[model samples]
Target: MTDAPDRPNGGSSRGLWILIYCLLVPAVVVPLLVPLYDKAGPTLFGFPFYYWFQFALIIGAAILTLSAYVVSTKADARERAARLERRDRR
Candidate 1:
């Protein structure tokens, strides 16, 4: 009753969501991890563990988010190419 290529797009669009989840790892990790760093055992440039940990989290979050963007962009580009190829074949 239905063609193979006409199947629903399920796994075909999973990359963006996977990328989003990857970035969310840091957001979730920081809140839970920060409590453990609420002491001054380590110091960076005179800042206590609490302060330096926040800075490191900021940088790490940024990197994770940037990587997510790149991954999603690549996924989108691949989708576009697939569409174009199907159109050409038709």
Candidate 2:
């Protein structure tokens, strides 16, 4: 098929990134704007509930973003390898 090679590799791990972003955006934003309903702990660096929540969210987002990047790259590489293998076998 002449157009077969032109077709895009349909396996995109971007969904994971999107999911992470979706979770993270709200995690970071919600925490800052709205305080936690129930929690009693001494504030760190004199930061209030909202500030602390935002700080933790940012840290969590960073970790998730890193994980997503690694996983997506690995998946893309694997998919590329499989495609190449199929092409070679043909």
Candidate 3:
């Protein structure tokens, strides 16, 4: 069987995975800290600060999730391509 080529740095993608996790952490963690937004002052369009903040968090989480999805999709594609190339070389 033919040997596959070696990639630089052992083909590690740990950094990209870490970045993806970082991008998703706030989306999961922020909303759980209720004390940060548990207030009634600073109303927005007749809504309390707490209500508006939660709405904003929903939008923020969606954007962050979408970004994470995009990054992971690209990473997965690259990994798949590398695997396929290795298989083809065999």
| RMSD score of candidate 3 (Å) | 3.8
- What are the per-residue Cα lDDT tens digits for candidate 3 across 1-90? 757466533474556688899999999999999999999999999999999999999999999999988988877776777777778889
Q: Write down the worst ten-residue block by lDDT for model 3.
A: 4-13
Q: How many residue pairs clash in each candidate?
A: 0, 0, 0
The true-versus-predicted C-alpha distance at residue 66 of model 2, in Å, is 0.5
Reference-based lDDT, each prediction: 0.74, 0.62, 0.85
Q: For candidate 2, write residues 29-70 as lDDT tens digits.
A: 654654452354567778765557666877877776677667
Q: List the residue pairs that clash in candidate 1.
A: none
lDDT of 2 at 21: 61
Give model 2's TM-score versus the native structure.
0.56
Question: TM-scores, in order shown?
Answer: 0.68, 0.56, 0.84
Best model per TM-score: 3
| Predicted candidate 1 versus true structure: per-residue lDDT over 1-90, tens digit per residue | 766563134435566767778777876777586568889968988998888887887788788878878887877876776687688879
Best candidate per lDDT, number? 3
Candidate 3 deviant stretches above 4 angstroms? 1-5, 8-11
- What ranges in model 1 sit over 4 Å off? 1-16, 86-90
For model 2, the run of ten residues with the poorest summed lDDT: 4-13
> Which portions of model 2 show Cα errors greater than 4 Å?
1-42
